[model samples]
Target: MLFLKPPGVYAPQDDTSLLTTALHEEPLAPGARVLDLCTGTGALALAAARRGARVTAVDTSRLAVLTCRLNARLAGARVRALRGDLLGAVPDERFDLVLSNPPYVPSPHPQLPRRGRARAWEAGRDGRALLDRICSEVADRLRPGGVVLIVQSAFSGVAPTLDALVRTGLDAQVADRRYVPFGPRLRERAAWLRTQGLVAAGVEKEELVVIRGEAAL
Candidate 1:
C-alpha cells in the first residue's frame, strides 16, 4: 500500500515489518477491532484493515497522525487516525488486537523527546519510558481473548516486558526476533551502550524482538 511519511514522522522500518508479520499470524475473528499504537505512516493499521478488521491508529505527533490518515486514504483502507499519548487517546475503547512499534532505542537522555525526529525513536535511558507504560496499561484496553504485539530491541530488556505482561494476567512470549545492524542512532551511542554493559565489546548488532501478549479467555 502507498504510504507518505513527512519529515518528522517515522517511516515503516524493520520493527514495523516484524510486528506486521506477527499480526498476520493471529487468528483474528471477522470484523476484529484492531488498535495500532504509535502508528507511524499507518502501515500496520492499513495491513489490519486490509484483512477486514476495524482499525484505529494512534500517535502523539500531529505529523504522524496526518501521515497515517493520508496513507490510509491512499490504501483505500478505513482507519481512524488520532493524535494523543500512547493509550491515552483510546481510553474508552477496547480492541481484539493491539500492535505497537514504540520507541525502544536506549538513549543518553533520561527523558523522552518532546519533539523532532528523535521523538519517533528516543525512549528514556533504558528505553522503557513508553514501553513500561504499555505493559502496565495495555491489558486494561484488551478485550477477552485479545492480543497485543509489541516490538522492541533486546537492549531494552525483553525479559522485563514478558514479566510485565505476565503480571498483568496475560500469557506472553516472544513471537519473533531479528538480528539487525545498529542504526545511525544506536551506532552513535555504541560507546555509551558499552559503558552501560548493554552490548558486548565490539558488538555492532542488536536483536529486535516482537513480544506477544494474550488476554485471558
Candidate 2:
C-alpha cells in the first residue's frame, strides 16, 4: 500500500485504507473499467489495476496525478492518471465501477481552496460541496448495473447521500463503517465542530462510512 507521496500530494491515511478494504471486498471482474475520482496518491487505483481492472484515476492536484502515474509505473500496474476536476477528464466515458474518497470534512471556510494541499480535504461548511455534486453526476457515468463506492465521514450526513443517490435512480446505502481517532485536521476543528453541533464535547473519534450506490440494469 506504500506509494510515493510528494510533499504537496495527499498521503493515504485511515480513510484511504478503509476505501481500499472496501475495494477488495467488492466483486471486481477482470478487465472491468474502473474510475477513481479525487484519486490522491492513486492507492485505490493501483489496487484496482492489480485486480485486473482497467483503471483511470483523476485528481485536481498536479502532484497527485504525477505521483499516481509514477507509482503505477513502479508497481508495473497499468493505470491512466489524469489531472482534472472529478469526472471532468472523462465526461463521455462510462465505467463499470467508480471509486471516490472525496473531501467530506466540514470546514469553517465557505469556499473550497483553489490551490494547495487543502484542496484535497476542505469541502465547505457542510462538507457536501463536492459530495453532492459527485452523487448527482456519478450515476450518469456508471454503466447499467455499475456500482460506485464512496467513502466519507458520517458527520457529513449519510442519509442525504443515500437520498441523493436514490434520487438519481440508484440504490444507495452504507456499505461499511469504522470509528477512528480524529486526524490532525479534525482535531484542530474539534472545538468549532462542537459549537456547530457536528461533534460532541469530549468526543475524539469520528465515524467514517463507505457508501455504495448501484445503478439498475
Candidate 3:
C-alpha cells in the first residue's frame, strides 16, 4: 500500500520493511487485536489490518500520527492512529500482537529529541532507551499468548532485548536479521559511534535484528 509521508514523519525504511515481513509471517487470526507502537506511516498496522486484524497505531509525533491516519484511510484499512508515547497511548488495551520499529540509533546526546525529524532516529546514548522500556512494559500489554515483534540495530544490544523479554516471562528469540548500509543519520554518526565502540572503525554497515517475544499462554 502506498503511504503518504509528510515532512518530519519517518518514511518506511529497511527496519520497517523487515518488521512488516515478520508481521506477515505471524499467524494472525481475523479480528485479533494488534498494536503498532512507534508506528511511523502505519505500515505494519495497515499490513495487519489487511489480514483482518483490528489495528491501533501509536506514535509520539503529531505529523507521524496524521500521516498514518491518512495512509490508513487511503489504503481502505481501519487503523486507530494516536499521538502519544509507547504503551501509554492505549493504556487499557491488550493485544494479540504488538509491532514496533522504534528509534535505535545511538546518539551522542543522552537526552532524546523533543521534536523534529531527529525524533525518528536519535535514541539516547547506548540506544536502548526506548527499546528497554518496550521490553519491560510490553508484556503487560499482551494477552496471554500474544507476541511482540521489535526491530532494532544489533548495535543497540540484541541479546539484552531477548534477555529482558525472557525475564518478563515471554519466550523470545531473534526472528530475523539483515545487514543494511548505514543511512544518512548513521553515516553522520559513524565517527562518533566508532569512538563509543558501538561499531568497528571504518565499518559502514550495521546489522538490524527483529526480536520476537511471545507471551506464555
- On lDDT, the candidate that comes out on top is 2
Model 1 steric clash pairs? none
Instruction: For each candidate in the order shown, give its overall lDDT on alpha carbons.
Output: 0.93, 0.94, 0.92
lDDT of 3: 0.92
Q: How well does candidate 2 match the true structure in TM-score terms?
A: 0.98
Q: Model 1, stretches more than 4 Å misplaced?
A: none
lDDT (10s digit) by residue, model 2, range 115-181:
9999989999999999999999999999999999999999999999999999999999899999999
Q: Model 1 — TM-score against the truth?
A: 0.98
TM-score of each: 0.98, 0.98, 0.98
lDDT, residue 110, model 3: 99
Worst 10 residues of 3 by lDDT: 1-10
Judging by lDDT, tell me the better candidate of 2 and 3: 2
Candidate 2 lDDT at 152 equals: 97
